[model samples]
Target: MIPTKLIPRTAEASEPPLLIKSLLAQSLKYEPQREIVYRDLFRMNYVEFNQRVRRLANVLAELGVKPGDTVAVLDWDSHRYLECFFGVTSAGAILHTVNVRLSPAQILYTMNHAEDKVVLIHEDFLPILTAIKDQLTTVDKFVVLSDKVYGETAPDVLSGIADYFSGEYEALLKEASSDYDFPDFDENTWATTFYTTGTTGNPKGVYFSHRQLFMHTMGLLTYIIGYEAMPFKGSTDVYMPITPMFHVHAWGFPFLATMMSAKQVYPGRYEPELLLKLLIKEGVTLSHCVPTILNMLVSSPAAQKFRDNLSRWKVLIGGSALTKGLAQAATDLGITVMSGYGMSETAPVMAVGYLNEQEQQLPKEDQLELRTRAGRISPFIEMRLMDDEGNFVPHDGHSLGEIVARGPWLTQGYYNDPERGAELWKGGWLHTGDVASISPDYWVMIADRTKDVIKTGGEWVSSLDMENILSQVEGVAESAVIGLPDARWGERPHALIVQKPGYNLTAEAIKSGLKDQVERGELHKWYVPDRILFVPEIPKTSVGKIDKKRIRSEMKEQILTS
Candidate 1:
């Protein structure tokens, strides 16, 4: 075996660590005047934003937050939260962006598991904190974030635990100096932590180091900027994140946008009307979200008025599969829509849909088909499909297998659960648990989640494929397909659909539509759902993916009772 060579460092050599603070510094140097807006409440440039971040670091120090301490943030998407992305990590503390959408018990479980020492909570979530404050083992201080001013007393909801209150967010920052010297630390130091929104047990903890996040940001920038075929995102682009910041660093775009010095907008809470208003008023050019939020935006009555302004928007959909129907709807509005694929464990981005020059010349419909796929493997990412027997599957666009990936930025393991961590990285690759196929040209088409794929009569059926076909059907608003127990077949596919307003859709009509797909060879005969149930809504996880586990459970109960 050949010995690996090593390079010795000189005493005078300056090797600065790739830290989160460097991103802020680069943004200030490039475009200090670029605006960072927070839902019409506040607006500051990169310079001012940098100052607030420094003040936040100083405040943490005053609150006795030492390096390696966990500081949890419970707030809507706002400028303050953006500051914490850099402030807490740059100061050497781990920033735990608490998913405020989780139930009270789940939220408490995450906080306690993380052993959060300080909490910066929004006023709206005071009741949740009030309910669980007694159970919080390590938290010693609380800082309130609010749009309104609280003079001397805390809000009514904090009546019982006001003694634990440190101060308000703005008040603490104002008191702290804006020029603390942020110390440089090892790039491999853990910078941020959050819990995954799993369906079964307590959410698993995922943490990232400074180097991992920095590289993730750079990897996404290389794809978005280096490839002209990809969605247009540049320094001049006005960026807003519809995806909650709590989720995988908002897919790591906040850091990328900051590094590029793009104008940033943070919509405080996701209101359809407010998001639309911000799109027009702030001239938001680039954004990313799940399919449900995009559907809500395009289908909203408020969006009808701003169609002209929104025509220039470019959206990257992820956190779930992007159905052809939803992609077409967004495209019809002149919005540039594409899909990407990742999970909570992969630092959340491994591939994004883009068309090469040759493929871009194809018909619009063909292009849309490619754009809605899971996308090609991203730069610096090594991806392969492994069959059930652990052999590598060919990228023939037909053979299906679970997607496993190896990348510099992929999470090393779940924070404190070595048993699950070992399972996640069983073969030196992160198992994505996604059933998919890769084309010869490296395009990834996700068939279904490993657990969500239906096996009917020993034939596999992709729920995503079925739902995509149903989405194109007339009068179908949104759809979800789950496997139900069967007597003869191992399992049968059942679809729960949300009908469009003013359309009286029936099971027969939907079946007839899918039958046409079968004739056209677009769908397998067995892929058609045996039962089409019309429902008002489908349950969603905290991050907006369909809750198939929940749907499957409910249907099993109904079947037994019937």
Candidate 2:
């Protein structure tokens, strides 16, 4: 280690701990009047939101929550959920944002694994809790979250679990005192915990420290708002998160938006119509989501009707690769769309699309190509590509390697799993498991997931590349590519496609389209799928990513038989 001089600190100097409450305090100081809307149900300004957050902290304390305890919340994107984001962590308890889309068994496993002491569950998710209430060993209390009044009686789902009920969310907050001192602690304390939507076995738990989250928020603000040529977000922009808050804190936007004091809208559950309505009604200028949600919104009839209203909207696409076809579709509708890249363990944002001065002057088609890539890495992130032999791959934009990263905000390791955690951080760098080539200028173009890349005839074929090509084909609504086991080639590319309504697409037409790509040198001839199966829908993971694992398992026998 290089020796460095240390500065002497005065005894009276104060070093404030970087905590979630600090973000809330900034919002309170700057934009106390800015509103937070929850699905047309509740609307409150920052001052009131702060009171509610404080009340929630008090409520947790009254329910016997102690420092280092876990509080799990199962709800849609709502004001209540936002309150929990600040409140639970401010009180020195870890907030577990349960993925409500998981199956009952998985939900039970995650809640129990987190060792939840208090659960604040939405009425919509009560059935899920009801299914696993008997099996939960650590939960000490349950608080209901709902839009409508339960009146004198609780929902039928909570019939047998009345004793566990503390009270409803709003009622408890209303009853509790809105004054609580949020004490300062070590900045490295675990603040939030959530499990990844793993394709195999159980979802691994990942937690973030208050310091990590604070640094992530600052880094994102610097890159996204302060540095980008066409910034996706601003303090003046009205924000709505199309992504589920349960997933990586909606890619950590809630905290950033709060720190910026931007007006926020939370759609209850993602109904495309409702989302569009909120987009129109709230004048939502900035948002983020996976490509699947964007496809759903653009495909909806309401999108066309409200096309003019969406002209000012800017969306950052992540959770999966953003295809050129999807980006063009949104662009055609006058929506600004860009791609970002990160995973559940990365605090979900390591890189995002950024157009430099020269790149901004490029032609539309060239710009779209650049915008759909993973783009340049964010500030404070040290990223490099590493090969199988543990050698560093050059950033020449042609060498392929697995993307490994080290950053202040990246999860140190998986929660409570020392064995797997060691593997995750093997070389002191967090392995991202994404295969990509980085341009000399630092732009990242993702090829495919490490496990999802297809090996055919000794050549590596990127499923994501094939999917992106297929997405641009006429009449194709959605597509997914997987490697099918074969005797001759070892593995062959196979595709499942969902066609756009009113268009009948055949395998021959799709193959012809791939032939065009091959001729243009955009794809290899071997990259064409041996079989194309038109399907009603492609299975997606709980977080709306293409469930290629499920697809591969389901299609293997079917393709072999066929």
CA lDDT scores, all candidates in order: 0.89, 0.90
RMSD, one per candidate, in order: 1.7, 1.6
Q: List model 1 lDDT by residue over 1-562, tens digit each.
A: 6999889989899999988888878887768898999887789998888899999999999999999999999999999999999999999999999999899999999999999999999999998999999998999999989877534554443676687998889878888889988899899999999999665678999999999999998888888878743555555579999999999999999998888778999998899999999989999999999999999998898777787787789999998888888888888888999898898888888999879989989999999999999988899999999988888999999999999999989999988899889989988888989999999998999999999999999999999998998898888889999998899999999999998889999999889877887899977899788888899998898999999999999878877887
- TM-scores, all models, native as reference: 0.97, 0.97
Per-residue CA lDDT of model 2 for 1-562, tens digit only, reads 7999999999999999999889888887777898999887678998899899999999999999999999999999999999999999999999999999988999999999999999999888887887789999999799988777535554443675687998888778889999988999999999999998665668899999999999999988888888952364545689899999999999998998988778999998999989999999988998999999999999999999999888899999998899999999999999998888899898988888899889889999999999899978889999999999889999999999999999999898888898878988988889989999999898999999999999999999999988988898889999999998889999999999999999988999879877987899977888789989999999999999999999998899796687
Clashing pairs in 2: none
The 10-residue segment of model 2 with minimum total lDDT is 149-158
What C-alpha lDDT does candidate 2 achieve relative to the native structure?
Answer: 0.90
Model 1: residues with Cα > 4 Å off, grouped in runs: 150-157, 229-233, 519-522
